[model samples]
Target: MDKITRIIAYAKTKLQEDLTGHGFDHAQRVATLAHQIAKKEKAQVDEITLLASAYLHDTIDDKVVPDVAEALAQLQMFLAEIEISAKQQAEIIFIITHMSFSKELEEKVTLSTAGKIVQDADRLEALGAMGILRTAYFGGSHQHPLYDPAIKPVVFTDKTEYRKGSTVINHFYEKLFLLPKKMNTKTAYEEALRRQKFMETFLTEFYQEWEPEKANFF
Candidate 1:
């Protein structure tokens, strides 16, 4: 098999049983989106590195894997076995490690063009209709409340605070609503605006349904 095919096979195996939003399907979507964005962007980007990073991005995520260190070590070996060059491997590893939203909250991460494309693609997955479904799925899996007027969204000072006591609805306020402004590329930025508006409309309808009496007030 080709290197990319091999990487896809490995990723599918790793994410096969994930019930959370970060499953193999998510990876495939990100990979496809990354490729699309890369093609549209005028800036030069390493497509191979971006696609590989997209596919393998979550394999070593601490949230998904019990032994992050071990998983990363194995990933490094896989890259070597696939005969990826040192520079390409470095770029892929950097993108996968730093592309996370929680990590972005902790520190400012500067990425290469390839990294930027991959990050944009992954962020795109967290918007629009698919974004809504994924958020609901994650909330259900973690037993977070769907919505609560009494529990307002907190401005997260750190990853821990962000992860703590989160309701699904509040996630839009804290993250999804802000993603359009955070997009790295122009194409992605424009796409994000459409998705962001969709999310806002959905939220409005959701609240209306939740409290029909208050619907007329808005």
Candidate 2:
């Protein structure tokens, strides 16, 4: 209804069509999580901006944005059209660029509350049944295995190992499981618990499926 809200709706619809850990379904789920946490956090953060940030967080994701530099410039220009100020635009870009687990060790950047909210929202999607589905989808897309019993997730001694790390499942152990501890709000923390249990259950089932004795149980 409002100007920013309209920008958000249009941006989301477009990203949903072009982006994916699978598709728009994933974006909607993340957006819902953002709204849920936003409602529960009761922080002084702007709901419109926070929700907008969440919905568009992955607009320029490594997987989504084909030409990273060009996409980013286009993204900044797009935000300009929506009447967000330069500082507010910086806040949104800072959150998306710095909040990623993949790049967290590469660079340490400060976050705004809006950025934190979006970070929490996006990470939450990587933790539940939804998380499992997205991981398998992305892993399959990237030619990574569904699970690799031979290769255990390595504990990083440094960022290099973390960057060139193991399969996508390794990402769950290395990062998603650790996210709840990093949550900036009570709302995000509580949601993390439910999703964490979900990921745990998923790993158990996935491993079980690979074992001869448990293979047919499903």
Candidate 3:
């Protein structure tokens, strides 16, 4: 097997044990999508490392590892096992570390092209119709209220406050809706729009379901 594929396969084995909504399956899909768009974007980064990073980005998120530092250290060590260069490992870790919007809330780090690609792929998973489903699924898993009339969305300057906010609808306002604007490439931006539309549709349907006594008539 090729090096990048081998890296992802190894990571996938550990991640599959979690089996949560945004688990290994989600990461694989993101990596696949990123691969679809990577060549067109002229970000002077390594593609294999970027795609590998994309697949493993969420390994420490909600699935395999709960502790961020521990997860990263573990991932770094795994890369080391296969003779992956320190420089390449650093770049992959940087993207995985900074690519998260949740982490962004806690700390800010400017990402490289590889990071950008990985981030875009991850964000796409949260934006569209499918993305909206994943968002609701994740928010539900976290016990977040889907809609709160009183709790409006917050405009976050970075990642810390973003993680601090609750409510699934607020997630759209705080990040998903803004992702298209934050995209680093045209293809990624266009893909963002597709996902954004899905999110809007989901919110509309979700709120409509809340109409008191309306369901009785229909």
Best by TM-score: 1
- Pitting candidate 2 against candidate 3, the one with the higher TM-score is 3
**Clashing pairs in model 1?**
none
TM-score of every prediction relative to native: 0.95, 0.85, 0.86
lDDT of 3 by residue, 134-192 (tens): 77887887688988888988777765456555797888887778779878778899988
> For residues 120-193, what per-residue lDDT tens digits would candidate 1 score against the true structure?
99999999999999999988888999999999887776988777648999998888888888899999999998
Encode model 2's per-residue lDDT on 1-218: one tens digit a residue. Answer: 67556756756665766523735566667667777777677757766567666666677776776777776787788788877778778777777778777677677676787777777878788777877777767766667765676888766656666645578777788777888887877888888898899789877876776685867774
- Candidate 2 regions off by >4 Å? 18-22, 156-165, 214-218
Q: Residue 150's C-alpha lDDT in candidate 2?
A: 81
* Model 3 alpha-carbon drift over 4 Å, by segment: 42-44, 62-64, 157-161, 212-218
TM value for model 2:
0.85
User: What C-alpha lDDT, on a 0 to 100 scale, does residue 167 get in candidate 3?
Assistant: 91
Higher-lDDT candidate of 1 and 3: 1
Candidate 1 residue runs with Cα over 4 Å from true position = 215-218
